[model samples]
Target chain A: MDPQSVERPPSVLLAHRMQGHPVLVVGGGVVAQQRLEKLVPTGARVTLVADHFTAAVEQTALQCPQQVRLVRERYRESHLNLEPYWRLILVCLPSGAANHSDDAKGQSKSESDSEKVYRDAKRVFGAQQSVNVADVPALCDFYFGADTSGCPTGKGEGQLGSMQLLVSSNGVAPRYAALVRDELVRHLGELPLAQSLDRLDELRAAVREEAPGPEMVAVRMDWVCALTDRLGLRGAASMDVQEELKKFKDYCKERGEQVKSPSQDN
Target chain B: MDPQSVERPPSVLLAHRMQGHPVLVVGGGVVAQQRLEKLVPTGARVTLVADHFTAAVEQTALQCPQQVRLVRERYRESHLNLEPYWRLILVCLPSGAANHSDDAKGQSKSESDSEKVYRDAKRVFGAQQSVNVADVPALCDFYFGADTSGCPTGKGEGQLGSMQLLVSSNGVAPRYAALVRDELVRHLGELPLAQSLDRLDELRAAVREEAPGPEMVAVRMDWVCALTDRLGLRGAASMDVQEELKKFKDYCKERGEQVKSPSQDN
Candidate 1:
């Protein structure tokens, strides 16, 4: 098939794993607070450097001590390299960030506080760093998803489940993407998605054991694809596990030559 | 609110823009082909290094010449330093990636081809670079979304338009996320999303002009949020622009103090 036949998007969307990764946020205002709120959920170890903190920001830092570390000091270039390397360097200062330090105020006059912070980060971290400035899309190495999809945060009991879904509009229409996510959460939240997902994982392990070896690699892939398409996550938990395994073996005996549609059989 | 009250996800999901950015892929087989297919859509300039290529992989490189460049040679350590720095270094090889180059084969025997490739990438690129090995989640810095959401590619006329929605399941259950994406595509693909977004931008510009000043920042934000909640992207295009602007001015007259619910007003 012609590659041109498939239209390409302008940017690639990826889920940056920040469970234990080091990230830097260099401001302490509402925007900083919002960024911190989002990052906290992703389990990132964010090191925030700001002398003054709003009541809300301090509360969050104090509560989620594991995820957030507060450094009550003004921004400094040394903060960029405090650790070996920061996975992401995010500056959440408002445009024209005030220069509270009177000593070094006259060195730069042309750029705003935002621009100064961005420039300092790039200069200190070099070209290898992925730095993002708040409200500045042009200088961003990546953009966070408008919101998370099927986050399972609202998935009863408020337990943070292992499963999460993120939705992005690629910066074209973030608000709309958030609306779409709200609708998805409405549909997905109602289902016992977490329970279904657990069951699906168990079924996958059984299938893997049943079809071992490189010779059965094709069989394994096809069966997995077919099962996912037919039952989705919900079916695994709802269906009889042993019965499904029997049916899978029967299909494998045929070498999966024909299209396997469990939906039809059901 | 207590930070522990809201549980955080295990990872942070983000959208990484790859347009015109340099990326290195260290294999050219089927797994490499899949990564290439995904990368091509993001407009990444991928430099693939491999002694051999699959037919499908060759076809893609030939078709999308701008996005892909072929290096007809085995992956060398020098490839890691080819440019200023690689945003992502991806190794796509089957496990126990055979040492095709036998001269150095005996140097490493315990590790399989997959493990070797992953090791080489980390050793060469250092900890600063985000390296990924295919099928190796433990070695990945980030994971791609299950599927793109509301991509305007399917929006009639086949023109790659701006505006898209992406959904991810935090790698907990990717297949389940893909199923969720299919549902999102079905609901969103039907709307005149791109055109509506254009209208929304125009409306936002008009609102910004009328409510110019830092004092009206709150008013601007609330009105825009209310507009999105009430009409969404579709309403921006469907409604009379002039009439909406007039109503917006009336709200500003009231200083936006009361809870402004455009849904009720509409």
Candidate 2:
């Protein structure tokens, strides 16, 4: 097998559009609703395929006008009317062949059964379309990343950071990835450098376009971040740091004062 | 509603037992094996319950000394009978509903009535153990977080400033937080702060045990981080500034370092 023929992992800022694509979301519960929420925002013409749905999914379906469609039955290969309408399909079912328990006790499906669904869904969606599963990593084109809203805006508006993906090189459990994702998230949230990067990205566009060179840009960013940390507690540290540096440089040039280096400033 | 009687969100830590406990990991596919990989290290007697398991789960069951119970028949509620042996159950099944596709497809009852098997299995597991279905947040006891395995020690260690929780207050989507986590992890990796924080934690323990006062400890830490950043930088700018500062300080000390005013430094 040639390595060049193998599939590649998705990177940040790939920006694929789902808008206006007739997409089918399989599964009636909250997971399906969550998937729909993301898909709808991307402008996918979503069709809900489930005999029953939670109130949230029903509400979402009602709100979307003609953009959303609902089916009133469990999934069948025939229901997957691969007519000209449906372009993308999202499988949001539980994996079966369960080692834990059976369904009457509200237990999950068997693992092989789950894999069968994954294989079936993948077959329907094919490689060209986005086939995402809510919790099943084995059948997903992409795992939804975590998003941060209401941060002071700069370059990437509504960008996601600090994400976790559920991928199976050998095709396996999505739930296990969930555990890893949660722990990584909590740990990353408190890191100081993550905060600094948030600030660094603000000036990244400016640096890319206007800086004398990449080295100077990198050095200037380092200096700016360091200066921001040196200053007393302030919100929007990056913007404030840049503004203060500009003011200081202007003051020094106007007054003919020798501008002291950071090391000597103390 | 009485404020005192109001229930708050439970703070639960899923402690992986050092001595190991019986953990029934449902689904006998790659995902089940993946769950087993994480569980075995914590010492869990893992039982893979599935009608059909993949080669990986089968191999893991064979290699591990922990009790491996494989039910090759279609799953039923009796599968949940390991209550005396297993208390914690992880449902990684592909779907929670009855597997009725075979009946619809005109398959024989003995060979294809998987839906009946699934329904019976679900009835035994109950809602608390039903984690496989999407939009079943109330059914789950824990949500997993992401991890970065790039640290030099291999063991996930180190702390950041403050306890930060990246929450979706409105519960729009949790995965978007991943993108934020990615940016943060990369940023934190670049900074000296995380390593310094680890050192600072050691100093903090010492200070808390022996320091004269908290204010003194705070001032000491403040100056330490400030000076370390200044000295750690490369290039002539840092060197020239440090040399100038040393000369100024020496000159002042040589002149008897007298402070005639209250605000002056000697």
Candidate 3:
């Protein structure tokens, strides 16, 4: 077996509240475009620095002028310095171009350049920053092998309430990771996990208003588990929301708890 | 609708080569244990700094003496100082405990304590490090919601070649994220994406030996795509590997290329 073919386990991290965080993205090719699409939804303040961008990336910039900033220039050490407090830097330059400078001395030069970018980001942001060098795993602090096909646009009330599923292969086979992710998306779509979660949220809120205690916390958890099982057995779409809510209220009432209807709270 | 229920997009990052990197995991609860299990596979040098340990975490430490260290104490700011090059810190204490000191001055105490941990980690490791304060989204620099149910052991040839799937919900709903992840794992088990990836790996090596060029790179990518489609249509376990290899060789031979068999390399 080839040593390169050997897969290593990955450490996965999910970043929340990237809104207004400065992100520096180098290269505007297909990979950069994909990264941008993922980043934009996070409400990140993204600045794309590439000598030339693919038509798709340019279109995305035009579409989200508030979120994405376009800087049409080749990557340089100065690019890292010129950022408005960048927290994450994504180098999406093609691997072929990077490998072109991979001879003994050429390798060090490219490696040093990549290292400098990471070092500079660290110096500026203080170890909270992450750098992803596309296709160059050795130079990257993080990898971007996420299959985000199931991600919902966080727009309006309904869309914001939906669940987002992301699968990462951690620099393993991209195609395989994508295949598995696509399959997961399909299976997850068939379940009423989202609806169940929404109901749980409502139930939890009602429980908190009525009786907030350690015991109630466990009760809420038990209720969620039981509801999940019921939803799993009977399709979520087929189940009546009013019936479920009524049953839930009845359960609380039996326990000598006064529960307000979720609709009443609104 | 509660503003907190609105889902925000997540920035997913996969860290590479975590071996020997110092990881500080606070709280030895089930969440901490789950995080440790995922961290151990990455070969991360972990230090579980908790007041106590779960039975399973203790067993894990006994099994992997070199990889995991037990602090056997409550989390303190000074704990970050005692480290062998800390890169990541996971705070897995229950949110209720974290929010216990959430009054006027009490809130500041806990917030400042959390802040100090993050600040100290950045000071020691620079901005390249990540800090995940479990359940407290406000205090965390990153969230740990990865469902690594399909990760391989990363030992020996066969185990090293398997794919790892991770799903993160970015702290929107942990239970929902886990439910979807479990469903995905079940569906992915039915696919032959991993086997197809192994075949692609062999094919890539053969291509590199015979026709190593930019053109070959594109050809390899195209071939992988075609093979993925074929594998999707045909059950991987039922399909004949020998026949597929023969067909692959014929396709390469048509382009005036000679390919070596994967078995021959072994």
TM-score on alpha carbons, each prediction: 0.80, 0.32, 0.76
Please list all clashing residue pairs in model 3, or write none if there are none.
A126-B127, A127-B126, A127-B127, A127-B128, A128-B127
Evaluation by lDDT, superior candidate among 1 and 3: 1
Ranking by lDDT: 1, 3, 2
Report the lDDT tens digits of candidate 3 across residue range A1-266: 32133345555445445766778987888878988877787778789987789898899899999988898876665676665456678877654453332233424443433454555566666544567665455556665554453233222223324455445555545655555555555555555555655664555455455545433555656675576555652244355555666666677878766555533443
Tell how far residue A13 is off in model 3, in angstroms: 6.2
Candidate 2 CAPRI classification by DockQ: incorrect
Docking class of 3: acceptable
Residue runs of model 2 more than 4 Å from their true location after superposition: A1-23, A37-45, A72-88, A94-117, A124-202, A205-238, A241-266, B1-266
Docking class of 1: acceptable
* Model 2 per-residue lDDT tens digits across residues A24-56: 777787768776766665456788777789898
Q: How accurate is candidate 1 locally (lDDT)?
A: 0.65
Evaluated with lDDT, which candidate comes out highest?
Answer: 1
Residues B63-126, candidate 3, lDDT per residue (tens digit)?
Answer: 9999999999776656777674566788777644543322324245544344555566666665
Q: Candidate 2, residues B83-178: lDDT per residue as tens digits? A: 443434555554333343323444344432333433433445432121221222333333433322222223222432211212221111222223
Candidate 1 ranges with C-alpha deviation above 4 Å: A1-9, A98-108, A124-126, A149-162, A190-192, A209-219, A246-266, B1-9, B98-108, B149-161, B205-222, B242-266
